[model samples]
Target: MNLNQYIDHTKLGPTVSLAQIDQLIAEAIKYQFKSVCVSPVWVKYAKEKLASTNVLVCTVVGFPHGTSTTKVKIYETKEAVKDGADEIDMVVHVADVKAQNKKAISKEIKGIVKAAAGRTVKVIIETAYLEKKEITSVSKLAIKAGAHFVKTSTGYAPSGANVTDVKLMKKVVGDAGEIKASGGIRSMEDAKAMIEAGATRLGTSSGVSLMEGEKINGNTTY
Candidate 1:
């Protein structure tokens, strides 16, 4: 399947520069992917850069690490939305979940969802750190907490968006919500597979390169 529409052309890193965000916006405008995902710090600039275009602006809350306090994540979500972020992707507290502190994780995600104030909220589950049952429980909790999507990873983890995790999230959320597959999805094949496995959204920095390679080379295996 053609997976371009499922992409959120992403660029989130510790050292991502303003010039890089501009370039990301430029590439998003050129490619017209679903959106451009950036860090919360760059939301304002990313919003300004994307203002003229129809491309949506997305920024993360709780970020790569989900260790932030619930209040902090909520505050980050509020500030990100105020800065013009069209969508909020917040990381679910993996530690809380792993410790069986479901209440804390639920509260954190719910805070972010409410902070969104009706905007789209995607909860990152960081699947690499969770088992199958944990994945199911988190998906259910996120859905119950009013999240619009369940995301697979932070990309900073040891692994990202495996087909197994995608399928698991898909099974749990089903038609009630959406699933976003991210991290380590660098090729057209992986992107397509994620979509097939029920990922409605894809987050990756390799979007432009993926398309370029597809153009320069046919569907033959790389």
Candidate 2:
């Protein structure tokens, strides 16, 4: 598949405004990116902006923190979908997963997945906070919970997706669910490495820069 075909050109931050989202949608339209992941508050606007295009509107649930109650996450997921979000990226309950409360973690994921109603739901395990073994176990729970994809991070963590983490996640989920390797993917080389590591999707804000990097420096600048 084309590398750009796997990219979700993301630009989600508190500093982002409606004007910025307009620019983002314009960029997504220009690049023909696979999707545009935005904050939930602007999902409606994003949907409206991209209504005429083929791009999908993706929103985050539980956001950078994955500690929200299941009810709240479900509510958020439902609201996003209602607002025209095509995909929901929900964070996993890190504490529950780390404490070995598999039931609670699975329950949380299942609730959100159910609320998504078979829409593209990607469970963000936030791999930055877990060990390799934890990543594998959590991925299994995410898949078992009926999530369509297992995502790496929220991009607000101290670190982001790594080649090793993607490889581990891929092994756990196998061919059942997609793997979304996000965060810190700033170059085509980095994106390629992750794809080789089994990442079927990439979430990155540096997509333009990565495309720029694809330009060889054989000649002088214009």
Instruction: List per-prediction Cα lDDT, in the order shown.
Output: 0.85, 0.86
Task: Residues 1-222, candidate 1: write the lDDT tens digits.
Answer: 555677898888789898888888888989888899988888898888888888899998888788888888899999998999999998887887787778887778777888899899999998988989999999999998899999998887878888988998999998999999888776777777888899999988878877765422332111
Model 2: lDDT equals: 0.86
Q: Give the TM-score of each candidate.
A: 0.93, 0.94
Please give the range of 10 consecutive residues that has the lowest summed lDDT in model 2: 213-222
Error at 215, model 1, angstroms: 11
**Which tens-of-lDDT digit does each residue in 122-146 have in candidate 2?**
9998887998889989999889889
Q: What is the TM-score of candidate 1?
A: 0.93
lDDT score, candidate 2, position 3? 68
> Superposing all C-alpha atoms, what RMSD in Å does each candidate have to the true structure?
3.5, 4.4
